[model samples]
Target chain A: MITLDHCHKYFHKGSVNEVYALNDICLQIREGDFITVIGSNGAGKSTLLNCIAGSFFPDSGTITINNHDVTKWPEYKRARFIARVFQDPLLGTCPSATIEQNLALAIKRGKRRGLGKGVKNSERDIFREKLGHLHLGLEERLLDRVGLLSGGQRQALTMLMATMIKPEVLLLDEHIAALDPKTANQILGLTSDIVGEQHLTTMMITHNMKHAIAFGNRLIMLHQGRIILDVDGTEKSKLTVDDLLQRFYTVQGEELSMDSMLLT
Target chain B: MTLYAALGAVEQGLVYGIMVIGVYLTFRILDFPDLTVDGSLPLGAAISAVAITGGINPYLSLVLAMGGGFCAGVATAVLNTKFKILHLLASILTMIALYSINIRIMGGPNIALLGTPTVFDAVSVLGVPPYLAGVVVFALFAILVAVIIIWFLSTELGQAILATGDNPQMITSLGVNTHTIIILGVGLSNALVALSGALVAQNQGAADVGMGIGTIIAGLASVIIGETVFGTASIARAFFAALLGSILYRLAIALALGVEFGHFSFNPSDLNLITALLVVSALIMPNIKKRLMQR
Candidate 1:
């Protein structure tokens, strides 16, 4: 569980070009809440996630992760309870490292690494089993460099890696946005399967409206550094993209403008 | 070349092989083009020579030299990471500062260890011929260092170091403080370079402030030669290749100096040119092979 109280993040404070990336905000994310977030460019979706992940500290207010204040924690320190898969395939996994080596790194997530063998023979079976689940034939190619894998395979590996240690929170930053439709669908299926099996507290930022509506138990829409809509369970299930658009108009008292919101 | 000359080259090669391994750690493993070795090598030599002149045990002087080099590396890492200085610039700054530091450490520009009992002299008491003593001592230490480095690189912390170099963001997300990893990795690299410098000072019986001027080039030449020739499919292979590469590089230099080529023999001053040519060929060898294969 995570909570943000009156969090504010400003870029270039007091300067002429000042911009508020996150405004006064309060959010309470419950355990096992698979939250799908939808927003347009500069809507603070990423800024919100960055705040929770400790990439940027809020100018005001506190971030509590399971009752521990983590506002001052560095990115690496907050990683003890958070795992992230970046939108860029290259950002999530080490390309030059072997598949097994990447998995080995993931297996020790949030833990102190000592002077012991990285890829133990005993752990290889677990890695193999996990890789086998991806159906990417990466199990047999553990020694092969990860750079040689396809983009979709790499993303899948990254997802598996992010959840390997079962972090307190999993953040997916438009992870499937870069893939082709077919590969995107496959990864989406895999993401759902993994999240369902683990019941992970996940926050996914997506540009695709269909996925934003289809995947998670709850959906929250962000607009101009603030949450505009929050719907869940049966209310979330019965809603359509048209309903989302009407709600956007009703909430903001203006017509929806972002084509990305409707096209996806 | 004569057998004695070949053995002598091997002796020098084995000693510099340790420095080549250090170079490999920064250049290949960390993807850091650290210029601090130019300073750290002399720093080690200066410390060892100074310590030896002060009546310290020759072997113990090497340890002190390594400590000095580690500090130099940490300074470079700190400048780069904490101060936000570019890595290359920070290393260059360290390298420049070390010039004065080395002179200060030795109390002058140079220190000679004439008549002092060195590691080679200690090995000579084992009944080995004086001509073979230098190579034997260097080989024993080189192998030990190689084994330790290989073992260290296989560890979890070592893997994190590798990941830090490979993907800093991913490693940071995995809860690794990449700043610490960079500090440790670069520190270890320079320490090894300093150790080699210390050994070289003992072997040649003197440490000159200018002794480390082209040390980085030579180390890079050896590593590129090693990786180009022997391949780096595995960590152990890569480490051994670096050592082998250093020996071969020394032998190549020896061969170059010895070859008359119809009155065009290479002199000592042409050593830089020779190193440059070797590195150029090594850099292009894969491409040449690939082009030939297409035919």
Candidate 2:
């Protein structure tokens, strides 16, 4: 579980171009909760996840993960309990490294890296078994550089890496946004499968409203650095794209004019 | 080239191969363009020469020299990582500071090791010919260092270092501190360069302050030439290529200086020019070959 207390984040503070990225936000992510976040551009969706991931500390706030206050920890230190899959497939894996090497790095997450062989003979079996499950034929190309994989395949691999060791929180920042529709659906299916199996506490940001409603048990809508809507359980299950848009219009007094969000 | 010159070139190549491997670790593996090796090479030589003249064991002095080089490398890494200076400028600052430090360590511009015992003296008792002793010893040390590096690269910590160089964001998300990894990598690289310097000083019977002037350039030339001649398909192969490239580079230099066509010959002072040309050709040859094949 993770909790944010009075979190506030700003960009270019005190300058004329200053913008309030996250403003006086407080939210608690419960155990086994898969929360789908939706917002238009500059809604602080990424900043909210970043503050929890310790990419940068909030201007003033406290974040606690699993009962430990990690607000001041550096990004690498906080990574022990946090796993992330970035929007850019290239950002989640090393292009020059082999598939097995990348998986080996994931396997040792949150653990001390010592003098043992990076890819042990025993771990190769595990990697093969896991890659086999993805059905991407990556099991046969463990030795091939990740650079040779397609964008969809890399994103799938990134998803696998993020969940290989089930962290306290898994953050996906538009992880499948770059892929085509079919690949995105496939990756989304894989994400749901893994999250359901592990009951992972996950926060996924998506631009598509249908996906925001289709996936995750809970949904939250952000506007102007504030969470204007938080629905869960039966309420989330009964909601549709129109209901969410109507609610947003009443709260913010403006139509959700992002065409991509409406159309998707 | 005469047989004597050929043998001497082989000896020099084997010794310098250690330095080339250090260059490969920084420039290729860590992707850190470190110039500290220029000064660390002389720092190693100075420490070893001074230690030997002061009555310490010759082999032990090599260790001391490596320690000195490690400190120099750490200084550069800290300046870059902790203080946020550009890596190139950080290494240059360390190199500049080390010039004065090397002189202070030696108490002069150079140290003579003509009479003192050396690592080569230990091999002379094996009934090896005096001319071949230096070659045998240098080859043994070079191979030993290469084997160690190859093994280290396959380890978990080594993998983290590789990932740190390949993609810092990916490794950091995997819970590894990239700053610590960089410091360790740069420090290890300079230690090897210093060890090579110590061996060179003993073999040449003196350690001069000016001996390190073109150290980084020659190391890079050897690395480039090795990668060109021998494909770097794997980590082990890349190291072997670097070592063999050093020997081949020395042979090429010897041949260039020895051969003459009725007053057309290269002078020793033209070594840097030759190295520059060799690197440029090696870098562009692959592209040229691809274009030729397309045509």
> What C-alpha lDDT does candidate 2 achieve relative to the native structure?
0.92
* lDDT at residue B235 of model 1 (Cα atoms): 86
TM-score of chain B of 2: 0.98
Residues A1-264 of candidate 2: C-alpha lDDT, one tens digit per residue: 899999999999999999999999999999988999998899999998888888899999899998899989889999889999999989999888899999999999878999999899999999999999899999999999999999999999999999889899999999989999999999999999999999999999999999999999999999878888899999999999999888767755544446546888
Give candidate 2 regions above 4 Å deviation.
A247-264
- Complex DockQ per candidate: 0.83, 0.80
What is residue A188's positional error in candidate 2, in angstroms?
Answer: 0.8
Q: Best by TM-score, which number?
A: 2
Where does candidate 1 chain B have its weakest 10-residue lDDT segment? B117-126
Candidate 1 lDDT, A158-183, residue by residue in tens? 99999999989999999999999999
Q: Is the docking of candidate 1 incorrect, acceptable, medium or high quality?
A: high
Where does candidate 1 clash, by residue pair?
Answer: none
Q: lDDT of all the models against the reference?
A: 0.92, 0.92
